[model samples]
Target chain A: MRKLYTKKLSKKDQLKDLEARKETVQFLLNYSKALRVVKCRGFTFDAILN
Target chain B: MNNVEITDAVLVREYMQGNETALSKLINRHHHRIYSFIFSKVFDRDVAEDIFQDTFIKVINTLKRGKYNEEGKFLPWVMRIAHNLVIDHFRRNKRMPKFDNSGDFNIFSVLSDSDLNVETQIIKDQIENDVKELIKELPEDQLEVLTMRIYKDMSFKEISERTGVSINTALGRMRYALINLRKIIEKHKLVLTN
Candidate 1:
């Protein structure tokens, strides 16, 4: 991989990134869970259907 | 073509016909390419793992229900599911996060609410405990950052200094930790809250 150097983040940008992460965690969590409910339990026809 | 490798199409057919191990063969055969594809898009291992597992979960469901009919195109079909999952990941991220960590940034507000009913409150307590336990499962750096941020109530700057990492790296660890926790919670169908 190339060493693609970048500039340092400003204090404002760092704080902004922190705040953004704090906010988005919940939504991402919910979406990931919704993708599968059958895997937790065994893979059965009734479970997949329902 | 006897020396030729068994094709994915053949594996899918066998799995559908009650050969359970065929699926594992298929997974092993394509795991690297599919995983790399997912990781390239998300650029995070935890998120990529979730997406990869979810992709195959969807695949198994389709195959079990006898709905997989994309003959001779198994890899592409799987790739499509992975692609859609990547889209789903970003779609959720793009939404305006509903948290209100506003000007004061009160951590308590994010952690608990006074208005929950009895059942939900109890469940939330259990989930919180489970999340705390899950902390031990995180990578060392992520565990360190999460421990300090949530329990010790340290700001990112403080965590960055204590951990000897940039603020961005600190936040990244927290994100990966939460992502893994949420994946486990969902896999078990644990209702963390109302």
Candidate 2:
């Protein structure tokens, strides 16, 4: 777990860091989305339908 | 001729000549790294997948239209396309609330509000934790770049200046870190939640 040193952070800064961290997590979760998209492209729906 | 030994330019030419296999060969050769690169950006499986397909479709259309000019560097070119698509996704969905980081935001509340069941939520959280743990396994150099960029939210130029390395070196470390992370994910067969 990454720790944010909040002792020195102003409340506003703390909230900003929290928002940034949340955005990072959201971005990380999207990682596999690209992999699945690429993999799926390899399989042609035309071949299956035929 | 073995498709594997042919150059990217040759493959592009063959593909443009209605040789579908040539395109498949090109895709097979570069898909892993390209996909890994895009996955590192988007993180969501379905959205990344859509962009990946769109990138290639654009690649095909560009080739057919004789717009592809990068003779031997097809992978980077394809990645550029995927990166643009990710940017477009965010732009199009700018109004959608991606994450709530307010004081009232709770993991339980977020999970419960979603359509996923409790068990699925647990699994998803577990996978996210596992992914974070895997990131720690990276080399110090790679980890430093990834941490500063992703966790600290630093730009590559800032990271380079702070770490006493060239901007290219910082960018290269990030690329290697993503590639290594992708390898780890594949080796562990870790399934990420959509």
Best by lDDT: 1
| Model 2 lDDT at residue A1 | 80
Residue B64 lDDT in candidate 1: 68
- Model 2: per-residue Cα lDDT over B77-180, one tens digit each: 88788889989988877967476553444787556664778888899889878878999889999999999999899999999999999999999999999999
Q: TM-score: which candidate is best?
A: 1
Q: What is the TM-score of chain A alone in each candidate?
A: 0.30, 0.28
* Candidate 1 lDDT tens digits, B75-164: 999999999999999899889444654344678866886798898789888878888876787788888988999999999999999889
Residue ranges of candidate 1 with Cα displaced over 4 Å: A1-45, A48-50, B1-3, B96-194
Q: Please provide TM-scores, in order, for all candidate models, with all chains considered together.
A: 0.42, 0.40
Q: What does DockQ come to for candidate 2?
A: 0.02
* Interface RMSD, one decimal, each candidate: 10.9, 12.8
Residue B189 displacement in candidate 2 (angstroms): 50
Global lDDT of each candidate: 0.72, 0.70
Computed on C-alphas against the true complex, the DockQ of each candidate is: 0.02, 0.02
